[model samples]
Target: MTETTIPKRGVPLWVQIIIWVFIAALLVLVGITLNKRQQGTVQPGDKIPDFTLPLFSGYEYEGKSEVKLSDFQGKVVVLNFWASWCKPCEQEAAELEEAWQFYKPGGQVIFLGADYVDTEPEARAYLKKFGITFANGPDMGTKISQMFRIRGVPETYFIDQTGELYYVKVGPFVSVNEIKSIVDQKLK
Candidate 1:
């Protein structure tokens, strides 16, 4: 019997390269879609998302250990995102603490700090150094940061008494008075 040779059936190099490029593009598109979803779009006049997290530093409110955004409903909420390693956060720490003292006593406002991407020991040290007494907790897996679409540290969000987002401050606040002015407006 005579042996017959079979022809090779291989994909062309150019077609192979094109297929890989298409796959890479598809993967990148998918990544962008997921990223957009993760970075939620929260705007003023919109109801702020509620979250509950364990406080790692600062005071526990009303004999409860965990801090919940919903707990402060019908009250103005100052939600601040910060990290121990961020200098701007350090600069505004005093201002935040002062605001906390002023409003906390009135029972019409609540200041909560979301310590973003930081270790507990370092965060506690930062709070201690800054003399921060407001409720502060780690953002645990950065869930809160993603919800707020935080771009950097020292970002502050003010929620009105009705639980609607009123304003967003993206950097270190000038003074406690400045924050109080906004809080006063929201209170009204």
Candidate 2:
């Protein structure tokens, strides 16, 4: 009778390596998904994400090249997302400027315009047309919109003094009072 060697009882080396690789990939995918979910969208009462926005030509704040959300720690922020081609944005353009002017003297509130999906020349012209004097900047690759998960143009986010989101307006404001109503409430 010949003595036969016993066969290995465990998984083959190649099979085990493949399984570990697949498991690692799965873990990485799950991690990425969770991270995206955490930063996906902001809502009322949630802290808004901080971002540095490069001001467009002639829109700098305090002569600075860019502005960061964290820079205004104790001030209410009126952040508006608009596009040069948006008709609804045009409707509220002057109203927003009026509201900005109304709050500018107080120094407790700041208005920030984030131009979305527009050429610099057109954005500048739109600002000039509306006579916008507050700090305005380009979104630059739509990063700001992505942070807020904006559905469309003309969306505005009212951030309270504590840096939490106070309100969200999906459409353009109809009047200066309409814009002021929200900012005024946030000021409180």
Candidate 3:
């Protein structure tokens, strides 16, 4: 004669404990990954989706106010995403500033910066430290980062007046010449 043992109704105590432990571990890992992704890690050829996140004031000399992607339409825009803590971003800030200076005269291309995942005070401080005179904004809640799916700091999007992304630079620009070359290629 053969007999079958039935499984426990509320799950085996040992098995339940193991499952709970695993679930807890998994939740913890997921939470960490999500926090990391909030800062984003972008890639090339990613389409620039339209987003209207808040741009904090005081970074620019005049018209120092909030700006959205839609705000600067009808002009070639260099939308650079960066943070205060990124070394490469700090390195490229001046080059981007120079590009802004060069392009501002012709009104050919407008350059704007976004202080991703940072405080207004920190962002403004970075601007002062890096000598980035272009207008900037704070991604207070990281709305813009999520919207564009930014992979990391120092991602520059060459967007035409229609808000279409033409080129994406993942790292810093070395010189105004380099910035100009890319801008010239796309602004037209």
TM-score of each: 0.79, 0.83, 0.71
Clashes of each: 0, 0, 3
Off by over 4 Å in 2: 1-17, 20-24, 27-40
Candidate 2 lDDT for residue 174: 84
What overall lDDT, based on C-alpha atoms, would model 1 receive against the true structure?
0.86
Q: Arrange candidates by TM-score, highest first: which order?
A: 2, 1, 3
Across 1-188, the per-residue lDDT of candidate 1 in tens digits comes to 99999989999999999999999999999999898877554778888778887787345666567877888888999989999999988889999999898887789998988889998889889999999988878888899888888788889999988789989999999998899888999775
The lDDT leader among the candidates is 2
Report lDDT (CA) for all predictions.
0.86, 0.89, 0.77
* Candidate 3: segments with Cα more than 4 A from true spot: 1-47, 60-64
Best by TM-score: 2
Clashing pairs in 2: none
Error of 2 at 125 (Å): 1.3
Error at 85, model 3, angstroms: 1.0
Ranking by lDDT: 2, 1, 3
Clashing pairs in 3: 40-151, 41-151, 42-151
Whichever of 1 and 3 has more TM-score, that candidate is 1
